[model samples]
Target: MSRRGYARADRPGRPATASAGSAPNTVYPARRSARACEGAAVGADIVIIGAGFAGAATAFHLARLGRTDVLIIEREASAGVHSSGRNAAIIREHADDAAEQALLHAGANVLRRGELAAFDRRGLFIVGPGQDEAARYCPRASGRGTWHPDDGTIDVSGLLGRYLEGQRVLYGVTVLDWTHGAHGLTVRTTEGDVDCRLLVNAAGPWAGEVGKLPLTPYNRHLMVSTPMPWVDGRWPVIWDGYRHFYFRPESGGLLFSCCDETPGRPGVYEEDPKILDTLQQRIETLQPALGAIAIRTTWVGQRTFAPDRRFVIGFDPRDERVFHVAGLGGHGVTASYAIGLRAAEIITGKLDGRDDPFGAGRLF
Candidate 1:
């Protein structure tokens, strides 16, 4: 790979150091040791693995609900090591799944309300065939589609910081294995064993492996063009809903994706350059008025989902102590706040999710 390739590759897939102006590093207390069977090196009432959107958002809500005895373990040195950090950071509420859409609406509302900083609220336009209703919102848009007045791009890192604010997270701690006991559970990690009454598997792309679930991770690519002077940064995100392609003004240019999905393993993504050709072909066929695009950089990211493509958020049937908040697919950012709130409610016994569309029972 070339120098630029190394830089872009580090963006979405590889586990690299936090970028400048990203989350600041925090010092964790020294690790303590305890008897293997009798106790644990660390202890908490709840232990969540993976400090990505799922884990951070859940912890945030748990704190909001007055539950402070929580601990988050992250394999990477910082949060959003994988998909959470690599995503395009667009907040779109429309979805084919009613359940997912509900969460998207709730979560996107929170983001759009200025609860967090670094949001470009230019709005979004989903242009497609027979989207007369959508066209009403973005009449100035070049094509007909639904207009999402609140939809726009966000500074993902800054948003992540808000979710992790005042949260107790231990970075660089990898969960090796865990054993559940009559009393609670003991999680074995690279740092040491952590004992907790409840465990959450929100490891994003690695959630399937961490929680022993059957979640699948798909690789997708994103490209940013060199500075396009004619591009209007205030323009809404223009997306071809039916064609699975979208683009928005970014850094004086445009960022786009073909919405390609290919099965992939956790943390292992190989950028397929051929996809650029596909993107070009789609752009030419769908909307060529913008003229030729000079690409600057490209990267690949992962999106995990269940076989049914619905979210998995409930206790594992095999073990009540283990809860899952995985499989948000590419909607993790847009749905994080709602997901965390709902997961916190269910985890705290305030809600029974066995019948919920996103419940883990459906997976069994």
Candidate 2:
């Protein structure tokens, strides 16, 4: 699916360069020619770096608040090509942190409203040991669990489209560096330099480098099985909290993950073959009833996290003009709308998240 613009990259407004033959697992953004933005506007009231879920959703909320003159710069040729496009697309709002859970609830409500995209609402069944209530949610589940009839999947690309509609996004534009001074913030990119009153770093995996904050990007693997006639398409998503794995019906088959997290850098990801063995082991041990499953496709995506694991939103403590809408981690999909709304509220003075759980000050 095509995004409003190209995919976003890491290292927004930060001075960075990729060297030849860099580490295979760590990728860096390379500087591009300024010609990319030759005919586009070089100035805006707000310049947001990256067009993934964070940027798109923030732009969407800003427009709702009647704020225009926002320009989004993405390094990739399309949006959601990174983590936003690579998630499981599930909307389970059960988070260990209450602050994040609240955002997840708001975001899930946004999806169910049907304004952004189509939602499945197939429900979600979370299972763990000793609960003995798994059967309540999934008849096939053993042990204890809870059934959330509101949790389900969404059309991620379509949601991105809706959030980005009527927004000005410049794809294939790389942010070289940015500086904030008396004239406001000047962001230099491959397209050219743009002057803005505020600069938002929503560079996803690149957020750490872009905002100079403490964040790490971890890689996770997902696999889809070949179509199985016996597989039921209506089965609600089943997650095992103890086993650290989840699976749901997909395309007449099953899409599963072992929930493996490996620290890595940005850029392209090559599927790690070793994860297949890990997946098999987990499935055999935790979900053997499904029998042998043949994989049809596999992929790896990155999720960025703060040291505390809570989201890092609000303005940077070091630079108030440079705002942040990153560190959503894997919760980006489940909490995107609320994240954007919170960010917009903070930016427009409707609210201040600086001291809240999702605030950026805590990290400093």
Best by lDDT: 2
Give lDDT tens digits, candidate 1, residues 1-364.
0011001011222223433223211212212122211322257899898878899889889988889788888877666767887788888888998888989999888888766747778887878754554334433335666667788877776677777776666666688889978799998987667789999999899999988888999998888888877887887788786888888877788888899999998998788969879889977877676678987777778999999999899999899899999998989988888999999999887888778888888876
Error of 1 at 155 (Å): 2.1
TM-score of each: 0.86, 0.87
Scored against the true structure, residue 112 in model 2 reaches a CA lDDT of 83
- Candidate 2 regions off by >4 Å? 1-40, 129-141
Q: Cα deviation in Å at residue 3, candidate 2? A: 19
TM-score: which candidate is best?
2
| Model 2 deviation from native, Cα RMSD in Å | 7.1
Clashes of each: 3, 12
For model 2, how does the per-residue alpha-carbon lDDT over 1-364 read when each residue is reduced to its tens digit? 1222332223232222322222111112323335433455567899899888899899989989988778888888666768887788888887888889899988888888767788888888787634547556555555566677888988776777778776777777788888777879888887667799999999999999988999999988888888998777877899885678899887778888888888898755767878878888887888777778888778888989999888888988888889999888889987989999999989999996656778888887
Output the worst ten-in-a-row residue range by lDDT, candidate 1: 1-10
**For candidate 1, what is the lDDT?**
0.77
